[model samples]
Structure formats: C-alpha cells, structure tokens
Target: MREHRGFEALGQAVALAEPPLIESSARTDVGVHRRVNEDAVFADGGVYVVADGMGGHEAGDLASAAAIEPFRALAAAHGARDYRMVEATIELARRAVDTVSLRTERGAGCTLTGVVLIEHGGIPHWYVMNVGDSRVYLHSGAELTQLTVDHSLHAELLAEGRAEAADTPRNVITRALGSGDSRHDAWLLPVHAGGASWCALTG
Candidate 1:
C-alpha cells in the first residue's frame, strides 16, 4: 500500500482579518510486505497530489512517476487555481501513464487523488479529483466527511448489496490512469473556517 506523511501551512495570516491559516501533516509508508514504495506526492504551488502505483504491474514506480510528472509541470507553469487547467493537467498525467504502458508492454497504472486550492471572487475553494480508490476527507468540528467515492469492485459490491463490508477485499480498484477510458471524479469545495481536509492514496 502507498501512504504519505508531511506538513503544510496554507492560506494567509493577516492580522486575523483573513481566514485562519491552515496547517497539515501527512506520513506515508510502503507497509511490511512491499520492498519499494510506489507512491508519489506533490504538495506545492497550491496543488497537492498522492498517487499509488498499481501492484502486480511491471514498472509500477515508473507508472506513478509518469502520472505525477505532468502535475509538477502544471504547478510550475499554470499553478492550480484554474479549474480548467487542473482538468487538463489530469488528462496530461493520464496520457503520460498511457505512454509508459505502451512502452512497457505490461498493463501499468496508478490511482490519483488530490486537491487544488483555488480562488473564486477572492474566496478560497478546493478543487478535488479522484481516480481508482484513493480518497479525500474533510474534518470539521467532530465530523469527518468523505469527499470522494472509491471506484472499486468492493465498493460496487457493497453498493449492490452483493457483499458485506467485512468480507470484501480492499485492493481491487475498478478504474485508474492508463486503464479503460481514464475517466475521473471531481468536486469543488468552498473552504471555510474551523475545518480542514486530507487525502489518502493506497493500492
């Protein structure tokens, strides 16, 4: 499984006139069974991403690196404030992963989950995206809300009432970069005071 750990200080602190500054910490591990960590994270230029390479695929680490490379460029070039640009950025990452798959001759892919901090009319908002089973969550005043849905067989089975949660295997994802049509889910969340958000990308 892929995991991340770090700390971030976001937003502005201007004498209490602005919204409270946000601070975050994240940590990642390769787990006991895996020899290498096939995960990538980008938390700069207002773009935060966590990508998990698909296990059992050759060059899984390369696949994840390819998926995140474009976002690094996106953050450097256009930043993450533009919603249209963020969408296009994801598409670019997908194509990069596809290129890796074509060259390796082995089905390679990764799960991507991230949030971009943007502004609309001077108000901050979060543009969240998900592919495969990575997740985003919001924490607010004793409430933890799941912000993205998992695209996984286990999730489907649970939704269809064909399996119980305890009996389902968690690693089987239904969608990913370099697989199928490469579609992804997205959301726009208005940032508010007294709350924070986090994400997890696991394969």
Candidate 2:
C-alpha cells in the first residue's frame, strides 16, 4: 500500500507540470545472453518494450523473439495509454512464454521486461515489469536507483551479503523461458513524475 501511494503521488506530481519522460535500450545474444528494456510517458500512458535475443544458441533467438512478440501485439492491440491494457498485455506474454518449447543449447532462454507511461488529468505515471536477471534502473535527478530485483540465485546471495561485489557467481539463473518452467510472473513497479526518470531492463 505504501509503495502504491508513493508511486501515485509521484505520478500525480509529474503529470501536473514535470512532463517526465522514460527511455530504455537493450541487447541480446540468445542462449548466451538476453536483455529487456522499456520506457514510458506516464505510469499508465505511453509504453515501450525491447527484448534482446541471446546469441550462441539457435533457441535463444527463438525464445527472445517469441517472448517479445506478445508484448508488441498487446501494445499494438490495446495501445500503451491504458493501464489495464498494459497489465493484461503482460499476462498475455506470460502465457505465451509458457506455451513455448525450450531448446537443447545450454543456458538457452529469454528475458522479458517492460514499462508503461500513463497520464491522468495531465499527470504522468509509469508502470514497469520484469522477469529473469534482466534489470530495470531509475535515473532520477543525479541518483540512479535499481527498480527491479533479479530472479537469480546470485542476486539472492548478494542480497544476503553472501556474495561480494557485482562479479559473477555460482547458482546463476537456473530457469527461464522454454526451460520447462511455465508461469514467469513479472515484477511490477510504478513510476511517478518529479525528477527525470528512465528504465534499463538489461539481461
């Protein structure tokens, strides 16, 4: 509730006059690595998403392409201006991932992440989602804060102080799209206007 309120207030303030903007970019080399990125004009207004294909494996590219296709269709079908439409679109993508078959190539899977911008009474707000280690960062003013938590064992260890530095570690992501696991839920966040804000959904 507190988080919701915080985002709501922030969105309202930004919509009034700040005209906050959101931008994102990413790269993917399927199976080897994949990235997801997004940007929004408001919490519920405009939205953009990018999915990078993991290289090194044939399946990686397929997975990335499959994962991103749904989001693109959703955005085109419902438009990014509607909050419910965006949420529904995510659900659609999740289902689409579940239906895909995994490839034999090692570490072959895909990452998914996105953001939506919404405006109410001229106020701008943002909604974000992520799955896998692909990340989302917020650049507000001079401060850059990570907005999404990674779904990896390494990230878990870091959170518990069991891992040091940002170096790679054991227990990396064990599952991903087409890894036989169905149902990858998106981690959602709301962005409000005030300082300049952007998203980085990296795999």
Candidate 3:
C-alpha cells in the first residue's frame, strides 16, 4: 500500500541498499494476460518482499497487501536482529491477513516471500521468509540459487517421496496468508561481501 500499484503490462524497478555495503535491484512485471495485476512488491533498505495474491477474486489484492503490512513496519524499523522478533511479526501479519479474509464473503489469500537484513553475533545476515509458492533466490555473479522451499501441494508431494504425485501442478499451494494457515518457513544467512541479489516473484 505504500508503493506503486501493479499495472497490466507494466514493469517496476527498485534499487535497495544496505548503505556502504549492499546494492540490490528488483523488478515486477504484470505481463499481458491478467486484467488486474494483483501482485505487490516492497523494496527498501534491508527489506525486500513480494506477495502474489490469489487471482480471480478482487479481495486477493487486499490479502496480499495485508500479508506484507507487518513486514513493512518491520522493515521501517530496520527489520529484526533477533529471530524472535521475526516470529512475533509473522503472527501479527497472519492476524492482519485473516482480518482481510473475514471481511470478504469469498475469502482471500496470497503467497509471500522476502528477505530481511539482520545482525547476528555482530555480523550482518539475511533473514529469508516464504509462504505459499512465491520464491526467493540468491544471485551471485552469474549463478542463482533458490533459498526458500515453497509451501505448495507439489512441493508437499515431493517431500513425501511420492514420485507419482510429483506431476502435481504448482498453483495448488499448501500454505498461504489468509488461507487459515499461520505457518511459514525462514532462513538466516550471512550477508555476502560481494553483494548478492534476492528476488521474490508474484506477478
């Protein structure tokens, strides 16, 4: 809600920095298909996030914004150096998203993924978060590595070693904000001196 609204066939670029050390860039494109771009992105010092709202329902836009609201506050406060803070913030975010769904008769939901810069043992680190199928990637020079596991039906099937079910589609998310599931996954990593890229997609 604090940034630009997604527009059809539009692409947005953002430059984020951690001061004298890190420089990052992010973009979001609505492409040519959807009439309403229900995705939203937030990029600033030490925080980057993407929320892919469940399409077809107008409330998905609200759900995605609701999901990132708390994180936006966290980022404004420089995110969390303590892992416990992240947990508390996530709870707040879940409640906020739930409120959005409760207000809509058809319900609403979204996938969220992002990274926060934190300090651990006097060293800076990246605190990564993921819910639903939205992904977060770490880029170094020419190499890219996925850092978050998606909370989706296909991922669940693969985790259960059901090779036969691996063919399941990616859209069936197992967990998401406003889906009545308050759980998510996260990772804490040391910030690379060479500067790495973190991208979370929604549109």
Candidate of highest TM-score: 3
lDDT of 3 by residue, 19-82 (tens): 3265667666666977666787888767778888887444887887787788777777743456
Q: How would you encode candidate 1's per-residue C-alpha lDDT over 1-203 as one tens digit per residue? A: 11112222235522224643655555677789789888877777667888889987877778888888888877788432666677788888988898888887678889999887766445676778888888877766677877777988888888888847558888888888888846788766667666565655564
TM-score of candidate 3 to 2 decimals: 0.82
Enumerate clash totals for all models, in the order shown: 7, 21, 0
lDDT for each of the candidates? 0.74, 0.51, 0.71
Would you estimate the TM-scores of all the predictions? Answer: 0.81, 0.62, 0.82
- Using TM-score as the yardstick, the better of models 2 and 3 is 3
Tens-digit lDDT string for candidate 2 (1-203): 00111222332233245455544444433233235322111122245564433443345555665666656555455432655565666556545544543335354456665566654444445566656666657776788887666667778767788746267553366335544442333333444444455665555
Candidate 3, clashing residue pairs?
none
Candidate 2: stretches off by over 4 Å: 1-45, 52-58, 77-80, 102-108, 119-123, 163-171, 180-197
TM-score-better candidate, 1 vs 2 = 1
Cα-based lDDT at residue 36, candidate 1: 83
Which 10-residue window of candidate 3 scores lowest in summed lDDT? 1-10
